[model samples]
Each structure stands twice: as C-alpha cells, then as structure tokens.
Target: MSECCCGEKDIYLPELATITRMQHMNETELFLHLELDSGKELGHMPGQFVEVSVAGIGEAPISNTSSPTKSGFDLVVRKIGRVTNAIHAMKEGDKLGIRGPLGHGYPLEDMKGKDLVFICGGIGLVPQRSLINYVLDKPEDFGKVAILFGAASFEQRLYQDQLARWAQNDKVQLLETIDKPHPEWSGNVGVVTTIMNQIDIDLANAISLICGPPIMYKFVIMSLEQANVSNENIFVNLERRMKCGVGKCGHCQINHHYACQSGPVFRYSDLSDIPEAI
Candidate 1:
C-alpha cells in the first residue's frame, strides 16, 4: 500500500490502538496513552489530530497532546457529546479505532531562529503542548521560548507537573493566569492576554502561536499584533468537527479550505482570507 502524507499507509480505514495508560487532569478531563495495535509509529506532526472511534459508538477528531518524540502518543478528551462521553468511559486496555495525524501542522521551518511564544487557554493546551515539546526537544534551533496558559481557576489547569518543571527552566519561560480571583493560588489572575503585557518580547524576532476557545481568538490576536508580532508569524490551531478524516464530508470545511485537509493550523495572514476562520 502507498503511504499518505501523515505517514500511515491507509488514510481512510481506522487503525486499532490499545490504550495502555490513563490520567485524569481534572474532574471532567482525562488523557489516554495509546500505542498502535500493529506497533507502527503514529508519525504525526505537532498540530495534527486523529479521528478516534469506539466499537459501537462513533468517532471524533481528537488532538494529540503528547509530543511526537515521546514513547507513546496521547489523546486529551473532554466529555461533550455521545462519542466523547463513550470515550470518557473507556479505560486502560480498551480498544480504539483511529484514523489520522491528518491536517496541516505548524510551520516549523518558519519558526526557526525566532523567539517563541505559546498562548494556550483551557483545554487548548492539548494541541499547543505538542509544538511546545517539539521546540523543547530542539532548543538550539530557536531563540527564547515562552508559554502562557489561562484557566478560569487553578483547578481547570492542565499539565500541572510539566508546567511546574518548565516554569523552573531559565531558558523556557512559563506564565499562567486565572480569570477570577483565587486567594490561595497566588499566581497571575486575569485573562491570558494580560500576560503578554508582562513578558519582555522582542517582536522583531518573535513568532507567537495560540490555541484556545474560539471566543478567545479576536482579543488574543489583537494583543499579539499590538505587540508588533507580524500576522504571518502568528499561528492558530482551530479544531472542527471533522467527520471524515479524508475530507469527503463537508463538516470541516471553512469557505474554500477544509479544516481537515488544509489546516487545523493556520497563520493569521492566511486566516484573513476566510472571514469565518476565527
């Protein structure tokens, strides 16, 4: 069989994967570690996603939270509807059907030699984490790296352990903010955009990337531009309901582009072409 762009031999059929480990991030969120049943490498890019299917239930486009360099890939899930609810009920050793690593990924080449900023809000950290780890694994290729995450409260934060370790690194700057007040939290308490004002960013040499709730896009983009980051240098990950990972179904289309085919990761300069891209 010929290989598709995502490195899988077949793009339409689902590959069976075994869930080997599981961890709960909060009350409603969990991360599952998976290994392909056939023992093949996923070979997914940092921003790509997989359409995960349960036996009787349907499938949903799930972002890869774990880094491509890690031993096992990760899928972060939040219960929303039927498919995700069934996925939430599954545990380690369960079987899952997957079909991707689909969609365009971040512009790693364009990111070379530039200072980096990652803005993640809520569960958006899942996809952004992939790129963050990629940069960390190859620090010599880039300049200073910074990650900023926003949560409504301390309990809503994801990747706590890694965040702590990353924050302690002098080369990797990490900052977080909470929307409302939490006296005991003792950390930044405001929207994530506010953190932009505090970091010493060299806009001339910086590239800003963001992945967050749709509502957060407008305000966040404004902040990055105000900081002098070029529209072409800023990237955003937009997750859509990609029913058919191959793009036969029209669910993931955004005007002329299909989110499942052309993107999921788009530079602000490209996003300007689609009014509904945000």
Candidate 2:
C-alpha cells in the first residue's frame, strides 16, 4: 500500500483497487466501483477521469462517475472495446491497475452560483454524472440545473436510475431524448438538442456543458450559441483513444492539446483554436 495525492496513506502505486461492486446498466454496459485496499480515497474532482487497466488486456480512459465527496469512485464501462469487454467479465475482488484521477477535471469553482445546463448525449452522461452529482451534494452553491440527455435508444440509456433521481430533484431538471423511439416511449424523440428548445435561456448568468460523440457537438454548440451562451461559458468533454493518462501519449492529441491531459474535459475557449476539438 502506498499513498495517493489525495493524502490517503498506504495506497498502492498508481494504486491497487479491488472491484467492490459491479452493475450492468444494460446488456452491453457495466458500471464498476473499485475500493482501494488501503481504505484511501481517490480524491478526484468532478469530471476528472481515471486510467484503468485489466491484466492481460489493456487500459482505457474512463471517467469518474461518482462524486468526489464519496468514498469510492465509479466508472461506467461500455463493452465496445477489448479492455472494456474484459472489465465487464470481471467480478467483485478482481485486481486492476489504476493511474490517475488524472487530467484537469470540471471547473466547479467557476460554476458556483451560476445556472447550469448539462447537455449530454449517449454515454456522455457517464462523465457528466460526476459534476451533476457533486452539484447536488452542495445544492446551494449553484443555481438551477437542467440535464438534457440523449441516447441511440431507450436500452442504451446509462444510469437510468440516477437520471430519474435528477429529474425528481427540485433543483434539477433532467430532459432526455432518444434518436429512435420504441412504441412504448413518449418523451422527446428527435434528439438531445431538441430539449434545448424548451429552455428559457438565461445566458446573462448561465453556463452550459456538452459531451457526447463528435457529431453531437456540431449541432449542440450551434444551438447553445443561439440561446446566447458565450463561447467561454460553454464547455465540451472530448473522447479520444488516450494512453499514458498523461500528456506523453500522442493518441488523444488535438492540434497542440492532449485530450488525456489538457483534457478529457475542456472549455470551448481553451480549444477554440484547436481545429480537431469539435
């Protein structure tokens, strides 16, 4: 056991954490909660991500879905790649390599007292959930919160239970939509951007965060600007094939920025000059 930057003592390098629990969000999706052997905390910021590795497989950049205030962090893994598939097969008590609650996390300091619009698409909610839950913990530190989420289908919705709880919160408004709807569905059906139409833009003192696939950003950004949110006030979370979890890896490079370090989370202003960011 070693220690993490969070000051928890005897935490192993990078750290050796055990799989405390696992939940299947759907047929091809899973969420894992790893408990550190030293009983130390990951001490991560909301929107900060982690680098997880499975022995004999490989590593993947994953977001910290749990709030920083919580004892252990949560990672939502979708079985689209080899490492994730390996992760999905593991159960409680499995050992894995952990490096980081790395990269620059969300800007919680700037968000204080500002109305927030959380526009998420697909598994975008997985990363945004970190900030969303953090805001809920200290509800008074922020203003109104609206979550606009979209997925390919209902079955693809991540964290359905948590999203429902957000919708139930008086301080939060969770608006969700699907690209294609089933006969049993009745909510917004076009896209996540459509929910933006229902918002009363409070751009003078509001901030917006957008995350999802690359294609989702083009339309979402255009819609946010129309609602009067400034380029500086809007943030986007970019996904890339990250390695090293630090800037050393070239895999997540966006012009001069390294998505793994400069961010898996970024403000439009920081990346406005980076052509590949969008």
Tell me, by TM-score, which candidate is best. 1
What would the per-residue lDDT of candidate 1 be over residues 1-278, giving only the tens digit for each residue? 65466874555678899999988889878889999998888999899999999878888899988779887699999988888889889889999998878888888898888888888999998898888888888888888888889997878888899899888877787888999887679888899998888776675468888899998988999988787777888888987878897778899888878898888998889878798888
Regions more than 4 Å wrong, model 1: 1-10
List lDDT for all candidates, in order: 0.86, 0.84
**Model 1 TM-score, all chains together:** 0.94
Clashing pairs in 2: 1-10, 2-10, 2-11, 2-12
Q: Give lDDT: candidate 1, residue 164.
A: 91
Error of model 1, residue 3, in angstroms:
20
CA lDDT of 27 in candidate 1? Answer: 83
Clashes of each: 0, 4
